[model samples]
Target: MTATIHRLGRDQAPSLEPMMALVAEDMNSVNAVILDRMQSRIPLIPELAGHLIAGGGKRMRPMLTLASARLLDYSGTRHHKLSAAVEFIHTATLLHDDVVDGSGLRRGRKTANIIWGNSASVLVGDFLFSRSFELMVEDGSLKVLKILSNASAVIAEGEVNQLTAQRRIDTDEEQYLEIIGAKTAALFAAACRIAAVVAERDEKQEQALDAYGRNLGIAFQLVDDALDYESDGATMGKDAGDDFRDGKVTLPVILAYARGSADDRAFWKAAISGHRISDEDLTHATGLLRSTGAIADTLARARHYGQRAIDALGMFGNGKAKAALIEAVEFAIARAY
Candidate 1:
């Protein structure tokens, strides 16, 4: 049987800005901490970090940290520092990822590596990683430190796993899910879990928040993978078919490849095997993804995870924060549209 695929519309998903407004006050504090911590005696450190930090990308991860904290009514200053740490970790990953992926653009601007060379990008990424650890240490919570620290390690492992799986057509859906979970979702889970820890909420609450983040992260990455094939440079902040050009086996490719005919499989095997891929190849691949319902199926999978993210919020009381958090899931899924 063929899979039923669902497509998202422009008005179908909720906006993230309203959800962000729900924690506008706390997010201001988090932003303050972020700017204050990015400073350095070495001119290049701040210059390079600031270039990316000020690039107008949505600060979603740190927003999650602050929103999670506020959801439990934690009126403490420590969450500020934790949220900044989350941003640092996220920024560091972007720096390193650009280098690893040889990306030239991010947030519709030149990537750090493209401007400053690979060494500078990599070192700056290291600097951000160290800064994140320092913030965790300053927070004085062993549990928070452990959660964020483990997330950092798991993210690295996920990067390596993705590297190992690169260009391999045999990469399965389960393996792809594992890679995204560790690389993207681990930090989301940590960010949400730390909020509960700081609030001194029960283990059940902590786990619930973690589950929400984990599922939300999966949905977010799935949409991102789909967008790489569907969006233009203006909308997606990068060129379309980047994943295909880079030989990265994202879910859209996986689903399409799995469901394709013999001739279709051969086409994918050649296109994804790191050969010289032309624009025409990408156009053809997009057609195949559409014809085989890969893009729609991928979005369907994102919706599934998005619903799980919403369900995970059932433990929280009904309020602006809870409603905003649920809407945030829809926003994450709607980016593709």
Candidate 2:
């Protein structure tokens, strides 16, 4: 088993540089497709979409598609356009999510919804969704289309699920996992699964890639959840207590609530019920999270999933692509550190 790499030493910190180098050429092609496809007669379509699209995201989903192809030793360029399509799907979700969450910042910058208003952001997101379908149709693979389209639907369902659970202090760990699996991990799985389809690989190989992506996605989300409470805004790329202020019952909060004292539980109920959103309350919440070991254990859960993601690649032969993907999992966990 490939052990989970810790980020205790900054000098040896895991980074995305390896994956970026591995996918540089193919990612360039995907970027060209993205730039060309984002153009439109209506100025706002491209402008608003570009604002978030060009935002400093790692483009992790599309990169997964490209890397998965390389892992299978695929030489064809079919995954390029599909990779752009995967990115478009991801960008569309981000735009809609910012609007729904009423988020003001992303990547340490103003969210599209904040700059263009909610309606514009949502409309532009719909435009991007249409663009993604066009790209998928151009790829002309029914399997790819089914995988991505189903992921899209599942993502929306997950968003809705989270919305319903929002501000409700009663949400549990199981429900939280289901929501993240749908909203975040669904596309990650689809991105890698479609690569196997385009590569003409066997079903077993496809399933392996899907599991790899899914577990990695879950680990990534878990880390982000921990960071929400453990990191500063500069490190988190957004507000530090955004999840807490918004009453999101992520795993850290779930664990803390379950293990909290009577007084602590009452505090959580009040904080999550939207009554304690001040800086002092957030400080208290953070102190509680630390005292109960919620944040550390949340990261432990992330390591568990990260290990699963690394192990999923066991059947693949050792090479640059496989090593990069493994490091990618390490980087995901290291983000919290």
Candidate 3:
């Protein structure tokens, strides 16, 4: 796939509303299942879980599940509950991630970890994982169970892999892809793939959906990493320099460091080693990223993956579902700007 990017302002760019509209009614059913399953006699269960659940997240993963099913022209209501399962898994991961990263803000609001504490966040994450498994079990498709369960395992492995690579400036592009493919793309693949199983489609169709979600997931993450430095706190919903302050060696840093002068390399080594993290340091880092063409190149890579995602849908016929899915790819790439 040729990665051609057409830059557009937020107002004129592709929107997610089309996809959301296509699945709006189905999402309501999924939301009902999510609300019902999150409840517990303990009371704290729903409170903490709901905190993030009700947060301003776009519910993209679950929406992918519903949209993929719609692309197959699924007639039954089975995708709704399964979509909730996908969401629970996603929310659980976010909770655990905030604690691991010691994050303070998400979607312009205080994180559950910050409000509820580390142990509470971790336990609630586990509870959500349990709820996801229960929903998967009720679906009674062994293939679906295996797909989602394996994704859960893969995500754990990816988290561990990222932890080891953290603050290590030597982490390469290939390894970074592997880490994100597991942590972020695995569930995305499963979320779309299961729709094929429920819709009783063949393996070819299932593989196509998996590819669509996987490529889109990678594109989504690359854009997020680029925005960590380029976007403001209000635009990003997290601190603008969170990755820099936390000593996370994302793609921008990796590329900048690789292409830097001796002094610039020293600066990067110091920055990723938990030093040089003041506001001015972040400013300097952003300048280095621009000078090295790292930010621009990172966005270019995202467009590559986004194009692959759009290409993965070529087998599907032209229709509202296909159009919305294609525009979703456009939106993901557009977010970096």
Candidate 4:
């Protein structure tokens, strides 16, 4: 998002130049295909969809789909369909997420739920989800359909589980992993696996892509969790304390709660579990997180997953595409800082 962390000004940050070039080389073309698919005979649907699509998502899911396909030298056009399908699924999830989280902002702008009414946002989200299925059907790939459908189901289940798990100070690392894997990594895994389906690649290659996506997605979400504890609106593109305020369970707070002293844990129980948090309560919670080194520790775990994602690419042959995959891994972790 923000030039992959550097000492110089954002304008002079080194990572964006190469990252942009690689993205253009690998993703820009497919992005156009994605745009084309979003068009419908009904003009308003397309227009509303366009507004969200052009909003500030990094489009990493679609990029992964396209790049994974390219890595296997997929020469077929169906990858475009699959890529667009992945983007549609992702956009649909974001729309649903805004409603579920009751979020007012994303990427420093009002969320779809805030701009359009929640009803319009929900319907538009459903439309995008249906469009994704349509694209998959047109591609005539049953495997792709199964993969994405399963991911969608898992995402929904994960959201429900996470909602129940929220503010429960006793939630463990295993539960945290399960929640993130279900809600975030499921789609990432599907995105990469569908590319293998399009390429008709070998089983081992497909597994590698799955592993890459799973680990990368885990890393990405972990960084996001850390950002809620460590970042401001300027860097994070959303209000700080939104996660805790929404009663969402995330890694840093989970870690802090686990390792905190008796008084600190009691404080969390009052503020988080008892739903007693105020502005002052948020500052106190952040202080507890800082004292426990929870944010730093969570970031270390995210970096480990990011490294695993890069290593998972070893099964693939050497190429610019492979390099791009590696860069993607680094980019996922870099966003934490």
lDDT of each: 0.90, 0.92, 0.91, 0.81
- Backbone N/Cα/C clashes per model: 0, 0, 0, 0
Please give, for residues 1-337, the per-residue lDDT of candidate 1 as tens digits.
Answer: 5543223334555898777788788888888888999999988889999999999978888888788887898888899999999999999999999999999989999999999999999999999999999999999999999999999999999999999999999999999999999999999989889999999999999999999999999999999999999999999988778899999999999999999999999999998997748998999999999999999999999999988888888768777888778878888988777
Across 206-311, the per-residue lDDT of candidate 2 in tens digits comes to 9999999999999999999999988887877898899999999999999999999999999999999999999999999999999999999999999999889888
Q: Which one wins on lDDT?
A: 2
Q: What is the lDDT of residue 237 in candidate 3?
A: 88
TM-score of predicted structure 4: 0.91
Candidate 3 local lDDT, 1-337, one digit each (tens): 6644433224677999999999999999999999999999988889999989998899999999999999999999888889999999999999999999999999899999999899999998999999998998998889999989999999999999999998898988989899889999899889999999999999999999999999999999899999999999999889898989888888888899999999999999999998899999999999999999999999998989888888888788778998888888889889876
Please provide, for model 4 over 26-121, each residue's C-alpha lDDT reduced to its tens digit, 9 standing for 90 to 100. Answer: 566667866887787877667767778888877888878877887888877787777788889889888888898889888887787887778877
Q: Where does candidate 4 clash, by residue pair?
A: none
Measured by C-alpha RMSD in angstroms, how accurate is candidate 3? 2.7
Better of 1 and 4 by TM-score: 1
Q: What TM-score, computed on C-alpha atoms, does each candidate reach?
A: 0.96, 0.97, 0.96, 0.91
Question: Ranking under lDDT, best-scoring first?
Answer: 2, 3, 1, 4
Model 1 residue 320 distance off true place after TM-score fit, in angstroms: 0.0
Task: Return the clash pairs for model 1, or none.
Answer: none
Whole-structure CA lDDT of model 1: 0.90
